[model samples]
Target: MPKVLVQFAHPAFSRSRVHRVLLKNCKQLEGVTVNDLYEQYPDLYIDVKREQELLLSHDILVLQHPFYWYSGPAIIKQWLDLVLEYNWAYGPKGYALLGKKMINAITCGSGHHAYTSEGHHQFPVSQFLLPFRQTALLCRMDYMPPFIVYGTHRMQQDAIEEEGLVYADILSGLASGRIRPEHYGGLEIINSLGHGAMS
Candidate 1:
């Protein structure tokens, strides 16, 4: 099975209802590592060497967080800016991350309609995620459309639980190569392992 790495960041995980549960579900699956950024680096002092090593070891990279102000939390951006450096994650000789796979698993407080052009946010969720997709592309990694949990503002217990299961199953399927090729069409990445879609 392909090893997975989830770079999880949430400023207020103690108060989070959705992300925490999702992390818990992922933790139960073997071969999936959830790296809690804030918990690991409370002082914002990231170990670049260790992080790079972690990236090299994992086949799939997952950025898991709650969508805050249409972007990620401050620390996740910090991690990207620092760890994905020159001659390392990007640039001429920076092929360390090349041909890898990346995807986001996020929770949105608003409904799906709120993210459309005719809705409140005035753009699609995919549009708001261009930066992330481009970053993955720049690193030569396949970028997959996010696994989104929408309508969190009024979600119930069962819905959150179901979404969590779906997220975990998706990760498991990616690692095990069970999801089919046809499902990869509008997807962001193709598993170089000849599995299915990128996780």
Candidate 2:
């Protein structure tokens, strides 16, 4: 089984409706380590070394968070800045994450259409996440299409719960090696594999 690390960043999990529900079952998986950035670094002081070590110990990395203003929470950006060092994650000797895989699990306040050019947000959700993809690329990691929960504010309670359960299954699959990196190649929404493969 692959060791998976789920790095969750939520500026306000206490008052969150979608993110809190989505995180309900993430820590229950055996080989999946759930690291809540805000919970750990409430003071905004992230231990760079420890974070790098966690990355080295995991085969797959999941960045789970709510999409705020088309970007991740402040802590995630800070973590990325401090933990992913030039000599360790990118530069000449930065091969620590070369073959590892990365996936983004995000919740958007608007529906899928809101991300389109014809919609309110102006561009596709994928466009908003390109920076994350590029970061993984620079580190030589395999970045997968993100698992998304669209229309967060519009989703019914049952739908929100179902999405949360599906997220748990996604993490479980990654940890158990049931979900291959190639399986994400053609998927636009990673959650589509929720039913058949996740179960």
Clashes of each: 0, 0
User: In model 2, which residue pairs have backbone atoms overlapping below 3 Å?
Assistant: none
Model 1 agreement with the true structure over 23-122: per-residue lDDT tens digits? 9998987788989999999999999999999999998899999999998999889899999999898888767998788888788999989988899999
lDDT of each residue in 3-64, candidate 2, tens digit only: 98999999888888888877777777889998999899999999998899999999999999
TM-score of each: 0.91, 0.96
| Residue 109 accuracy (lDDT) in model 2 | 90
Question: Each candidate: RMSD to true structure?
Answer: 3.9, 1.1
Range of the 10 consecutive residues with the lowest summed lDDT in candidate 1: 188-197
The lDDT values for all models are 0.83, 0.88
